[model samples]
Target: MKRFAFALWLSAISLNAYADSANCHQKANTPESIAATMDQALQLKQQLNSQPDPVVILVRQGQDMSSRHLTWSHAGYAMRQPNGDWRVYHNLNTCGTAESALYIQGLYEFLADDLVNQSIAVLRPRSDIATALQTLLHSAIKLNLFHSPRYNLIAWPFSGPYQNSNGWLLEVFARANDAQVWSRNDARRWLQLQGYQPSIVSAGTFERLGAKLFTPNVFTDDQPTELLRKGNVGLNSGDSVIRFIAHYSRAIPGCEHQNLGESVCVYLSPGAKRREKIKNRPSRREKIKNRPFYANRAACKSAYLRRQVVPCGPSSRIIPISVRRSRAASAAAQSFALRASRRC
Candidate 1:
């Protein structure tokens, strides 16, 4: 974004080629139609490249929207784009030039099904992603996102330290199902049935959310598991609070504030249980590790679907409850969590 936002300025210039608008909403067929499909893929790649919602830092800003293409592992060094067509060659060890990186909006889109069809058969990250989804879901089923299908991956876009790490499993499953987000906790359980007992603590934004909150005391780390306490937990331990906050940042999707790991930069709402959990863990009352239910890893988590399996369809096709609606909350109470983690 930061990079390609200005340099390319090419989308407007390139659109002139397709003069007449053909309403071929139907899937494209035929060689010429197929070629057009490739063109469409290029366009999609360009559009995505130009305006990515970057869930991860590695998917930097302003990389070439159309230039970065993956040929696939089944092939050679060349990798293919999420689209089946439009292959581009690049290096794995290096970041690409402006002409190479496509600005895929919301890095998570690059990990979706509409973007990744079953036919591509090139980059099969299903196992890895499915496993992570299930592992994360294992813990999320206990959270408030347990039944809402729409709130699966990016459940807590804005939250506090205690509520930060509950939704990573949703993203893991969404990536696996090719669905951008999950609609129920049952899907999580179903994935578990497939042997996807996801329980990793790898650190990344737990949700692929759109809202970003700025807070102190949170850090986004490279590990798979969330480390709530950089060192140890204590009531007066500012550093411990900061680490907990950082873990929260990773727990949230689309969160970019991880450097200011100090100060009360954000005001998030921790659910009653989370509030109680924090109180019972790092406060002056007792050491977090000594607690009866001490979460040794502090690998924050989220919720999953109900037993009802909803087929993957359009975002607007059907209606279901969401995090904002179904959480067991009182009118005066909020379900948000607070977190603060930065590279700082």
Candidate 2:
């Protein structure tokens, strides 16, 4: 009984943390909140002053509360300014639309999430890579071209169809490491070759269908083909980005495991080692192309239509087999819907 109670308590704490972290994007506009946020940013900036490198990757928890496994959700590049202050450059969906814009804001504004806990992770890259990233960020044309207007919540790191906040950072990181890379697809391929695995967000078939039909910002076209085949999507989270950096780059001293206010700081060494080539694998579509009813758009639509039914009324006489099945399916769907809402 004691163990069960302890487990229940742990679950409650986890839920609270997830809920708080997930709503970090709702900005607090009060003067007191703004002042406190600025003070926290100033403290963080001061901590970065001792680092030798001029550029670092800044990570923060996300505004998505539904994900239990995700601790960090957003990331951006921080570069030292002429006056020795660090400014963050990243894409943000500020207008609550499917559109996002690239902005270079001060550390406070960058960390202005209403639910932002006192925690930030900083990963510093090698001098050469930092120079490359700085150069790319300084170019107005490059920023404009790379800035995606549509924001896809589950935007695949490799696809060009749409992008989320983290997708933009992933592309910029890829381009910084390789000058020859010209497109988002190329960048994603490069990261794949480097063995970067994005975090997976799973949903039931009904949940996915509902999201597709209703959620404008949740799209599947930009998802990797393999994930789409499995009825899942890849999300580029800040934790995943940090993992990629740690895998490829050395961690610098003094930047690892230091406490800054309520936040812990980690610093990575500057340069990334070259990754060996991964063996070629068949694309998701290619592997599933011959399968019967492999979720082609028309087939999916037909299946959905076949399962949709209205209630039998006094004016109605006979209920078709399809309608009967659909009614039964509707009952099952209600149960699943309850579960899906709880998960979200």
Candidate 3:
């Protein structure tokens, strides 16, 4: 009985050792901090609304990775639902453990993470690719095929027991781009074929030792020994994922809004510039189609109060009584609200 009890205690200790708290120091919830988070969410919503595509890769500056010269620390799929509401699908570590779970959250919730700044980067994939990704994201089993609960902050791209959030996203993207990529290995192969490169982060000996000893979700064993010895580690990161998408589909830079209220958008391809020059002004027909159809202000207020605020026009201006066009929502939209209730 004593031996059995000792074994149980040992097991408990092992579990606790591995389950190191993963929470990092977060910014205090001061008024400025709260405002910054709200501002970022608002700006992101406005920008996403301007895009024609329903899905785009949203990168966040959640952590101060400036020491590694990395700008964006996380990436997630921002998808617009049929009801015109936006949602972010991403993997989040579970309760400060090495385990993680997928989270489907709103723009406000996504930006509320302890962000280092209010800046964000958006990568708009090609129309076909975006459509393919949207379909995959809607799939039940397919979405989890590349997801591993064992979290690693700097997981190796090709193969590893653990996976990072960005790494999971890259695998899913590979599967979407190539139908043959049904497995993680196949996804990695496709990524290699497409010349997808992982971002290199420099970690010296002391830093490596410190991270290995203290951090729960950081691991270096998956990296090559030679590279580790040289203090260079290659891992999947937001920047690397964006670079791959840019090359694979020739996605133009959408927007990089910094914390200082400055917005910079650079279109690499000439076609993107021409398209940008052509303002997306709503046509007279579209304006008429989008005009509200409510009979009076009372009916419009009732519909709005019933959470029916959708299909608002590009102008999205507040006018008397006319509610947004009340079109029959598609099957996808009908099912979207149901999916929102499911555990991610």
Candidate 4:
């Protein structure tokens, strides 16, 4: 029996290695980047992804995500034991289980597909599950995704078979807006196309927004101030450029406003244009789109509400975003049970 068990264990190890190798195994290997601009791209990705349906993984990866990344968007599944040690399968890049990779599967699932047929990125949703899956397979071979617990409350509503369905699809795109991952202009434009006016976002409110996006797994919003340093977004609070974009986004948030004047509570993309419509003296268009990331509801609510109060007066209709968490999300919070079950 002992001998048989030993052989079985070894065989299991070997097979595991092979599977991981096949998944993350990049032949030419993925191109790597050290540029700060990567932050902007990641920020955009976060906004687009929003609170991930598979919440637990995202929070784990968000910590120190600023580190240089080796792409395995083409990489495949590598299941490293929860132990910190790394492993690889078959013959691929040496990838082990880390928080970044754990949650990054969600992000990889999106980028693995050719969102763009041409040089431009595809902002549209993909409907072909088979084609989409193929794109994912290709990407899995090239990227390394990880999870970091340092980032708090990564949303992961999609897990197991529940992922990839249309119902979850809406949740994914909605999350992008929730996180302010897309610049406000990009988010506004995208949402407008989908007839979705996502909640307003604020410059420095990721934590609060994180609450809404990730459920069944929210970590503490307790990253130290020093550790909360912004990535290389090349943006700062109150910049003249940001202010201008904010101005437009506020006006054309969904382009559904009944009144184009102060009665409108929507935001516009920087370079968005009006269809030669009458009224509104200033051409309601700009040539660029840039907006801040949303981290918290308070901050986001403030940004949009201030405009409403000024123009539409206090009676402006604001949509309700649950400040309270879902029961499942609250239950999954780390340490909540530990503290409760063993109260001193």
> By lDDT, who's the top model here?
3
Per-prediction TM-score: 0.18, 0.64, 0.65, 0.16
Model 4 misplaced regions, further than 4 Å: 1-100, 103-130, 141-151, 154-344
TM-score of 4: 0.16
Indicate the worst ten consecutive residues by lDDT in candidate 1: 12-21
- Ranking of models by TM-score: 3, 2, 1, 4
For residues 283-331, what per-residue lDDT tens digits would candidate 2 score against the true structure? 6766544323312333333333464333323322211123234666777
lDDT of each candidate versus the true structure: 0.25, 0.61, 0.65, 0.25
Candidate 1, 231-294: lDDT as tens digits: 2111111122233223222232232222443311221112323554565666544442232221
In the order shown, the candidates' Cα RMSDs to the true structure are 29.3, 22.9, 21.7, 26.3
Q: Report the Cα lDDT for residue 343, model 2.
A: 28
Instruction: List the pairs of residues colliding in candidate 3.
Output: 292-323
**lDDT agreement of model 3 with the native:** 0.65
Off by over 4 Å in 1: 1-183, 197-212, 215-344
TM-score-better candidate, 2 vs 4: 2
Candidate that would win on TM-score = 3
lDDT of 3 by residue, 222-273 (tens): 8988988897788877768766766544333434333211222322123323
